[model samples]
Target: MYLFLNGEILHKEEAKISPFDHGFLYGMGLFETMRTYSGHPFLLNDHLERLQLGLDTFNIDLDLQKLDISGMIASLSEKNGLQDSYIRLNISAGEGEIGLRTTPYNHPNILLLQKELPPLMPLREKEAVLLKLRRNTPETSVRLKSHHYFNNIAAKREAGDDPGKEGLFLTKEGYIAEGVTSNIFWISDGKLYTPSLETGVLNGITREYIMELAGTLGIPSEAGMYMPESLLKSDEAFFTNSVQEIIPIHTFEGRTFPGKRGRIAQQLYSHYERDAQVLFSKNELHRS
Candidate 1:
């Protein structure tokens, strides 16, 4: 495999990082996961926008506007010989002294990694279980897709290795937070509902886009602190992320849901498929 690190593409095994890098030393870094459809990056601008916000919050100095991100993705795609792919754009604070510093990190390491992906199918299903491990509070005011990921890793282990199952997490206070690696949502009475960001859930990009899609379909959406029992009253439920898009939950807490057969899940996913086909940046979609 090959990766784009700094300004050049190199074999993954050949790429190197300093042991003193703050990102390595102290987990001071951020990353964004994106997917390409027919070689076009869906929601490229929005992902970068979120990435920029994370960089600002981390005190990592990097100007994305000066970089040709699309061009980079295209180059990596050609080099890796994959069109449908998973992309992780990472930026980490460069070398720093042993102690923590309040000063901004001027030099940061940027990396782009990709992996082949089969064409995503709409309404793909997964089973969810309430995890015993509670969601951890974000280190900052809002959660950034940063190097601090042990919480998610632990949740994944607790959920076990069933690829078709996703572990749902509740906040320390027992309010529904989100899936281990995705945001959770459910539909009831023609309305869509999800755990609010106040619950310390990561404000996922796809989560935001799904809410937008709901509005376009005239579906009222609400976000608030919810409990596991709420799924019992739900007609259908699904999970969302940049890569998986919309994953209909087939079962939760021993209760069965409509899953892929759900009317609302079908409608939202159909619209999601149509938009992904056109492959416009989320910003462009909003402008029109």
Candidate 2:
């Protein structure tokens, strides 16, 4: 496979970075995980926009406009013969000495990699497991998609012993925040509810798109602080991500529901599938 590091393509084995990079030493960096449909990236603009937002928040001055990422991604995909693949875009503080200061960094490290999509649990049904670990505090820097992933990794390790497909993270205040790598949503009384961004949840791109699709489909949805008790009492639950799309929750921790697939989740999944077709069609048209 070929990887894009800065403006050049290199063999995967040849891709290397300095160990002294601040991103490696201090975990000062941001990243995005995206997927392709029929060899075309889905929601490229949204992902780039979020990346820029993160750079702006961190005060990283990088000119993404001059990069021609679309062409680069297309070329890489073609070179690898990738039809359905995962793309990881990473921007990190460049090589720096052993110091806490950021001034030593001159150029940001840009890494783009494509890999075969990992096997996902067939969402033909919905399943979820409740995790015992609480999410990081609001002041604990959970908003940025930084390389500091140990917390989520630890939570997943603890959740591994459970029988569910995914872990649902709760805020320290006991309100539902999100899953380890996805957003959480539940249906109650014919309305959809999810945790608010103010609760320190990462504003996921898929979560935003799903909310917009729900609105268009006439599915009532809102984001606010929600307790586990409310989720347990809800009619149905599901999780969303770029790859998973929308997956229903059959069980939470040890609690089981009447159905594996919730009605609202099913409806939303149908709409999401349609949207994918439209996006691929548009991409094809643009290429033609």
Candidate 3:
């Protein structure tokens, strides 16, 4: 695999970052995992916008105009022979002396890695277990994907090595926070239900799109803090992420969903796929 580091691409084995980087020393970094459709990145703008916001929050003034993100993604995909692919785009405060002083990063490290994926199929179904880990709201602001990942890592370690199962985290208040690495949703009598962002949950790009799709597809949706047990009120449940657009949840802590593919999920997924095709056609973005 080739990794786009800084402004150059290198084999993964040769990729390296300074050990003194603040992102490594103090967990001061940001990342976005995205996927491609016909060679164009899905929601690249949204991901970049979020990355910029995080960089801004820390007073980092790296001018993104100097970089061609779309070009890089497309070129990287072509170079790696990836029409259908998984991408991990990461940026961290570059080499900084030890300690957590509020100093600006003079040399931020930006990297992108691409891997081939089979043609995207419906994510099908998976099972989940409620974890004992309590997700507390950030003492600062709402969560964005960041380097402080120990809580999530710990939860996943406890979740064991079941590929078909995932762990769900509940807020310290006992409300459903999110999945280990994806945002979760459920359909209750055709109305979509998910946790509100006010809970300091990670602002997921796909999570936002699902709600937009619900409106486009005319499925009523609501986001707010509800008891974790409230998931039982739904007929079907699913998780959303960039790579796996949607995966049905057969059961949550033993509460089985209504069916393999619920009506609302089927509609939303169908519409999403159709819309993407139309988007590619209209934009004429497929790369060879």
Best by TM-score: 1
In candidate 3, what are the lDDT values of residues 1-288, reduced to their tens digit?
787999898889999999998888987888888878778777777778777888877656686657898889888887888888888888898887788758678689999988887666664787878999877566358686778888888988988788787788888878888888788998777789999988778888888777876776578999999886779877889888878778788888668885446877787777667554334221222220
Per-residue lDDT of 1-288 in model 2, one digit per residue for the tens? 999998788999998998987888888788988887676677777788888877766656786777788788888888888867898899998776787874434589999899987433245445576678888853344488888788799888976854347887888888889988889888889898899998898988888877776776688889998888888888888888887666777777566764445678777666555555345222232332
lDDT of 1 by residue, 1-288 (tens): 999999899999999999999999999999999898888887888889889999999999899999999999999999999888999999999999999879999999999999998766657899998899999999988999999999999999999999799999999899999999999999889889999999999989889888887786689999998988887789999999999989999998889999899999899888777676555455444654
lDDT of each: 0.90, 0.77, 0.79
Q: Global CA lDDT of candidate 2, please?
A: 0.77
- The TM-score obtained by model 3 is 0.92
Top-down lDDT ranking: 1, 3, 2
TM-score (all chains, Cα) for each model: 0.97, 0.89, 0.92
Q: 111, model 1: CA deviation in Å?
A: 0.2
Best by lDDT: 1
Q: How many clashes show up per model?
A: 0, 2, 0
User: What are the RMSD figures for all models against the true structure?
Assistant: 1.2, 3.6, 3.4
